[model samples]
Each structure stands twice: as structure tokens, then as C-alpha cells.
Target: MKYTEILEVVRQYIEQFYDAKEDSTLTFHNFAHTHDVVTHATKMAKHYGLDERETFVVTTASWFHDTGYYTGEANGHEQRGAEMAGGFLKNLGVKEELIQEVQKCIMATVMPQKPENLLQQIMCDADLYHFGTEQFSERNMLMQEEVERKTGCKIDNNNWRKATICLLESHFFKTGYGRELLEYGKKKNLERLKRKETRGMMRKSHIPNSCLGE
Candidate 1:
């Protein structure tokens, strides 16, 4: 099949998979997030001048990267996603080499992401693209909701903000376009979160001992 046709098939399969395995708890890792990542990957691929085959690999990987969330537990979701993507592509008669590349791209999205090549770097950046977009606040809330629902615990807002700040500070965009286009927005988001955290602390400190119900 043509690369375009293959990509269409992958898209359809992933959409249907999400539909069939719908989990309301996965507010942040749903099909919408996958589509966003695919869009980002496509944009990055074009900017980097990836050929048809390379684009296909990255695009397909984006579509299936978080699918493991539906298939099993969140831990090692990347590995599960890679296996699922590999199996589906193998059935479609995709070449073994290309299939491996797709799996590698998906795996590269794991936290503390270690991408060995430009393609993998694109995948990593695309997965976290929202971190640098205006949607960061909304997406971050949804992610926190998903985590709280899955774990059955209320996350402390101050701690959550701290963790998010740590992530924003630690992560760096790998591709040139990503660094140039995303860094400023990411810094803005980080500052916003830090300010919120500070205000939350101040609010708590100003509350009287009797008001605190002690």
C-alpha cells in the first residue's frame, strides 16, 4: 500500500481502538491528545525535511504511542504501545525495518525521554508539544484529573504545581525548530505555575489558626 494509504489505515485503526476501549478516567491521554501529537509530528517532520518513509514512521508512531493506556496499566505503557503498533503494522505487511523504527519512536516518548535520532527527537517533542502551547494549563488540569482518578487520591495542588514546574525546568526541546518555537512559551508557562504556587502558599499562611480548624 502507498504511504498515504497506510497512514489512513493506521489512523482509522487507532480511532476505532480508542472508541472501543473508552476509559473516562483517561481525560488527558485520549484520542484528542493522540491527534494533537500526530499534528505536531507532521509539522516537525515537514520542517525537518523528512521523506515519505520517515514521515510515515513518525506519524504512525504518534497515532499509537499512548494506545497502551487503553490496553493495560499506565506503567510501561510505552512498551505496550510499541508492541501493539508493531503487531498491527506487521499484519499490514509493513516492512520489519520500518516497523521497528515506528516502535522506537513510540518508546522514545517515555519519561526522561532518550531519543537517539532526529526522528525519535521529533516524536518526543510532539508528544509533549502542549507543554509549550496555550493549551498547557487546560491540558495540565486534565492530566492531573486523570492521575487522581486512576489512583483514587486527591493530589495536593501545591505539590502538583511543584512537580509540573520541575518537569518544565528539566525538559528541553531536542529539535532546532522545537527549541526556537517552543522555548519561550514553555518558560512562560513555567513562570505562571510558579506564581500560582507562591500565591497558594501565601493564602495558606495568612489563614488564622482557628480558621484552619485546629
Candidate 2:
């Protein structure tokens, strides 16, 4: 099979797997999210003038990146996803070096992301493409729902707002196109988060003393 064909194979495989394993609770990591990330990665790769082989590597890595969620392990999904990618590419007769690049791309997407190279940086940015876009709020709500369903833990609105604000303030997009497309929107999102936090605090302070802790 051509290396080119592998992308389609991967795309079909993940869609089928997700269909078989669909969980409404996993709103954030479902097939739609996967497709969106891959699409964003593809666009960035094209913008950055990735050759065909580089495109294949980045896009294939994007395909398998989130699949470890199938194993129900949230903590090490990157390693699990890399292992899965390695096995799949091996069966496809992909080169050891190419497979390693793909694995590295997968691993580079882990939170507090540290992407060492251009391709890995694209993977990281694509994985977090939503963070700097108008869709951040809607996508975050999906993630919140998934977390609540899985962990049965409730993070109060104030805490969630504070955490999100911190994340948006600290995050940066690495590539030129990444920053071009996302940085301004991310700034706006941060301001919106701050405003929302302020409103929440004001509402809390306005609550009558009867509900306050003694």
C-alpha cells in the first residue's frame, strides 16, 4: 500500500472504530473532534509548505492521536496513541523512521505541550486549535460534560472559569500560520473569560448572607 493510501485507511478505521464505540459522554474526543483537528493540521501543513511525505506523517499522526481514549485511560493517552500508531504503521510496511516521526507527533500533543520540531509543533497546535477560536466556549462545554460523566466530579463554575482563564493566558501557538490564525482570537477569548469571571464573582458577592458559610 502506498504511504498516501495510509491516510485514507486511517481515516476510515477511526470513523468505524468511533461508530462502534461511540459514547455521547465523550463529546470532546469523538470523531468530529478528531476530524476537525486533522483538518486544521492539514490546512496548517499546506500553509507551511509541507511536502507530500510530511503531510502524510502529520495527518496520519493526527488520525491516531486521540484513539487511546478507547482504552479508557486518560492519563497516558499519548503513549497509548503512539503505541497504537506504531503497530498500525508497522503492519502497513511503513518505514521505522517515518513511524517514529508520526509517534513523536502524537506524543507532542500532550498538555503543557512541548513540541520539539516543526511537525510536532503543528500537531500540538492542531490538537489545541479550538483553544484560539470562537468555538472555544462550545468545545469547552463538551469537554466539561465528558469530564463530569467520566469522573463523576463536579468542578464549580468559579473554579472552572479560573482554570480556563489561566490556560488561555499561558497558551501560545508556535507556527507563524498558527499564530496568525489563532492569536488574536485567543486574546479575545481570554478577555471574554475574564469578563465572565468578574460577572460570576459579582453575582456570588451579591448573594444574601443567609447562604454564606458561618
Candidate 3:
């Protein structure tokens, strides 16, 4: 089956299986995020001259990256996504060997889990492209919301800022293209952090009595 056909099947599965009304995992793991990952993954794969087989496998993995969210498992979502991907691809007449490759790509995206192959590395970087993009602020907010909503973790301003800073500090790009092109965006994120710290200081400097005209 063609990639377009496989994507359509994945879309249908997300719509039919993902319960948007649910307040847990399915709430924020929407189709738009999947589409964004796939778009970036495709672009990166093409730019890097990935073979067609690798491209198809990586793109399929991208489409199913968040499938575990629908299953309500936070930690093993990559494995769940891989399982779902295998089934979806099999239905699309994808060969057994290619399906395994796609599954490997899916599993390679798990956080704290290192990618074992080049295709995996590419998809992993593509998954995190937004972190080094101009829209990183807004994208990070969505992720925080998803985590808070799903896990009931209340992230205060201080903790959120600290976590964002740490992520920016530790993030490493897998592809040279991503590193070269996305450096400016990462700098912007750093600047955003500095501005946040400055704003906090300014707020602290203000006197409540001044506002009351004491």
C-alpha cells in the first residue's frame, strides 16, 4: 500500500479509537501533533537523502508515535505505538520485514531511551524539532498541559521555568542539518528564559503599596 493510504488508515484509527471526551491520555494527544511530527520527519528524511524504504518506515513510525496515549500508558507509549503501527502497516499489506523496521523507529522515540539506528535517530530529532523552533514556547505549553492533565501534576511557574531551562540546556540534535539550521531558534529559547527571569525580578521589585497609592 502507498504511504498516503497508510496515513489515511492511521487517521481513521485515531478518530475512531481516540476518545477526545476522555479527560486522561486521549485529551491532548490529538491528530494535529501526529501530523506535525510526520511532516517534520518526512522533511528531514528527504533532506538527508534517506532511502525510500527508510523514509516509508520512518514516516509510518511518525504517524503512530503517540498511539500509546490512547491506551492511557505514559511510560511505555513507544512500545504501544510500535504495536499499533505494526498492525496498521500489516493491514496496509506492508511486508513483515518493513513492518519490523517501522516498529523499531517507533520504539526508538521513547524518552530516556537511546536510538539504536540512523533512521531512529532521524525520527527522534524530528519528534523534537519544535523544541528548537520559534514556536517552542507555545509548543512546550501544550506539552505541559498534556502532562498536567493526564498525570494530575500541578506545575507552578517556578518549576515550569526551571524545567524548560533544563530541557533547553540538555537537548542535543541528532542531525547536522537540524543543528545548523535550528541553532538560532534554540538561542531564541535561551533568550526567552532570560526574559522570564528578568520579568520575575521586576515583579518582585514592585511594591503592592505603590499600586494602592500609599
Candidate 4:
């Protein structure tokens, strides 16, 4: 199938099937994020001169990577997304072999699961392309908003700082291309987190007497 046709199908499926409550991030994880991943994956594949099949798999994976959020569970969203994407693609006349390959790429986005293969690595990196972006803080804020909207929990400064630190410490880009491209931005984000934490601590500890102000 043509890439454009496949993309259009995916877009239509997302609009028709995405459930905001079950997949809280569904609002933020709209077609724009899918498009971003596709763009990033394409760039990485081109940079490394990936085979045509590998590129296709990654492209399809990018299109459906976040579809699992609609499943209402964060733990296995990738797998669920992959299953949904595969079914849709197969119904759209995509070959079974290619569908499986695309599903593998979709599963590569799961946290704590590193991508061992090159194509998987690219898809994984593309799924998290924001980690190294200059607008990392803004993106992180959006993530915080997503969580708040989904779980109805507000993240205060200390909590947000802690979360940011944990994310920065835990996240690792599988491909050398991502590391080389986004490492510094990731570090900058971490540094910002550290500063925020410090400021929060200082504010909490610095209570002053009213008489001292006079």
C-alpha cells in the first residue's frame, strides 16, 4: 500500500476509535505526535540508509505506536496498539508478513524493553523524540498536563521535579543516532529539573517571622 494511503487509514482509525477516558493521553497523543514520530523515524532511517522493508515497518509502527493508549492501561499499551494497528492494516490489504514486522516495531516503544534490532531501535527513538528537543520543558509540562487530566492528580513543584529527575535518569535512547542527536538536550532538561527541585526545597525551608520584616 502507498505510504500516504496507509497514513490516511491510520488517521481515520484514530479519530474513529480513540477513547479519551480509557486512553487519557489520547487527547495529547493525537495525529500530530504520530506525524512527529514518522518524521523522526524517516530522518533516522535515511541517515542510516535502512532497507526499504525496515523503513516501511518503522513508518507503520510510528503511525500506530500510541493507539494502545485507547486500551485504558498504561502497562501494555504498546502491545495493544500493535494488535489494533495490525488488524487495521491487514483489513486494509497489507500483507501478513509486513503486518507482523510493523507490530514488532510498535512493541518496541514499551518502557523497560530495549530494542535489540536496528529498525526497532529507530522506532523507539522516534517515539521519544521529544526527550532531546529544545522545547523539552514545554513538552514535559504537556506530559504533566496529560497525567493530571487522566488521573485527576495535580503535580506540585516538588512532585514534578522528582518525576522529571526519575524520567531523565531512567530514559535511554537505544540508537546511537538518538544519543548523538539528543543527549545534550536531555542533560539540559535534567539540569532544569535539578534547579526546580532546589528552588522548591529552598522555598519550603525559608519561612520568615513577620517581626524580622520590620
Best by lDDT: 1
What are the runs in model 4 whose C-alpha is more than 4 Å off?
Answer: 1-27, 208-214
**Candidate 1 residue spans exceeding 4 A from truth:** 208-214
Q: Which is superior by lDDT, 1 or 2?
A: 1
What would the per-residue lDDT of candidate 2 be over residues 114-169, giving only the tens digit for each residue?
A: 99999999999999999889999999888888888888898787788888888888
In terms of lDDT, model 2 sits at 0.89
- RMSD values for the candidates in order, in angstroms, are 1.4, 1.3, 4.1, 3.9
Question: In each prediction, how many residue pairs overlap at the backbone (N, C-alpha, C within less than 3 A)?
Answer: 0, 0, 0, 0
- Whole-model lDDT values for every prediction: 0.94, 0.89, 0.78, 0.79
Which pairs of residues collide in model 2? Answer: none
Candidate 1: minimum summed lDDT over ten consecutive residues — where? 174-183
| Cα-based RMSD of candidate 1 | 1.4
Residue-wise lDDT of candidate 1 within 1-214, one digit each (tens)? 4999999999999989998999999999999999999999999999989999999999999999999998788999999999999999999999999999999999998999999999999999999998898999999999999999999999997889999999999999988888899989999999999999889989989999899998
Per-model TM-score versus the true fold: 0.96, 0.95, 0.82, 0.85
Give candidate 4's error at residue 97 in angstroms.
2.6
